[model samples]
Target: MKVDENNGTLAEARGLSGKKIKISKKGATPPPSVENKMSVGLIYVNEYYSGWKELCFRVLQSKFDSPERSFAPDQEIIEALKNCSIGQEMNLKQVQKLCMPFIRFKKDEAREVGTQALDLKLPFSEMDVLRENLELIRRQLGLEHVEVLSAFEVLSACDETAHAKAGENVKTAESESAVPW
Candidate 1:
């Protein structure tokens, strides 16, 4: 994938089949201060649409751009937060709910709340906790300084490639199964 350095938008992606997909984000030009500090990537979650993911990206970006808001937490607190798990398969609404307190509360209070939330045993194993937290941090930080593409866009492209390959497989199978007249 490639980003447009001027605006932090995803300018292109090379799909598995060597097809190039270009994405254009509306009104995505970051201010001078944030321009050089930003990056872009893609995340795929099961069963969510691109539009929903796009909405989440927009909301997170708005929060980061708000003059009154600051997302910096104490490094120690951020390290502690590293143990917290934000589950996969979470939709935009679910993530918004999880992040609301962090957005509203003071840094220390938010850390405490996040610690408590992380303590709950939610059917995920200990190994998965680290992975989940990493994803959470990526989303949070990505909102502030990265442009995240919708997973559906990339996944759909791969799916299309898979279907085309499958069609070719079926044709080959049928021809092989037939007798040479």
Candidate 2:
């Protein structure tokens, strides 16, 4: 394919083998075997962390007016997220935190984690809601005696969460409430 020098389109003048870079507005044609769909772990390689989030945030903010400053660039952020899951294993919490830059979860339901750690499907909008209401949930649950429910047995006990049912406390909250003032 011929690229015009006037338009800043890169042309492969030589028989390219290694370290040939192409920059063109009208993209180069892919090889016959190459599928049109994007690969699962496409990444933009650079020496540094590529200015981190702040640079991108400022760039995006400049593109939008003040009213749209808080608005997240959903498409751009999702594409960036694809790069994060590359060549690494991540739990649901890690994935959730990763996508938090773009969104938050809103509901109390446990995260439906993927069987494989890397194949996370954390969505931004849902995460945004979760982030906003996390404090409220912690307060509602009264996390004074916070317990980690790591196993099925422990989580199942939540269904019958009372000393009366477990035969632990002789005077249960129910019994205390039943007493007249």
Candidate 3:
């Protein structure tokens, strides 16, 4: 599979000689012979916290597209989540305050929104409600952890490793040069 840098579209190379082929976007139907010969699999690259946040928004929007419970998340709210920070913890009350306006709740037993059930008799705090909704969202998205290392952090780690290896190479070179043939 080859990725188009300009449009970020993935396309399968047609021949063994590396010829570019335009794969149809309409259902992306592969050639019969290639389909029979190749097994397709999805590979995620450069995925980080921002990508997860976007996926979460998409899942929530699709699951709760009703007029009563609109899932239109704003950039500010998503940015405030800071899901990329490894140890950053968001205040439950603060997240609840930010999310309450966008989410709708009903007191009736028959009504439901997203994964929230309105059948419980006990009153729940805004934080509790938000927590439940978030948990449901996480489950639906199949995410085990919300926190992820940012691209910058990953690059920094790679740089550190590279530098350490370069230092070792330099030491080896110096020792070899000092030794008599």
Candidate 3 lDDT:
0.35
Which residue pairs clash in candidate 3?
Answer: none
Candidate 2 residues lying further than 4 Å off, grouped into runs, are: 1-67, 70-75, 84-93, 99-181
Task: Give one digit per residue, the lDDT tens place, for model 2 in 60-163.
Answer: 33333333223345555444444453214445455445444434221111122321111122233333443454454334332222121212222234435432
Residue-level lDDT tens digits of model 3 in 31-104? 54552443321111222223323333333444444546444454433444444231144464544453434333
Q: Report the C-alpha lDDT of model 1 over 1-181, residue by residue, as the tens digit.
A: 1113212322222121112222347844434344443343332222221232323223333333234334443342333233334324355456446444543443343234433222222233422333344454345444342222222333344556433433434444334323121
How would the candidate models be sorted by lDDT, starting from the highest? 3, 1, 2
Clashes of 2: 12
**TM-scores of all candidate predictions against the true structure:** 0.19, 0.17, 0.19
Segments of candidate 1 deviating more than 4 angstroms: 1-49, 65-160, 164-181
Error of 1 at 113 (Å): 17
lDDT on C-alpha atoms for all candidate structures = 0.34, 0.31, 0.35
Q: Using lDDT as the measure, name the better of candidate 2 and candidate 3.
A: 3
lDDT-better candidate, 1 vs 2:
1
What order do you get sorting by TM-score, best first? 1, 3, 2
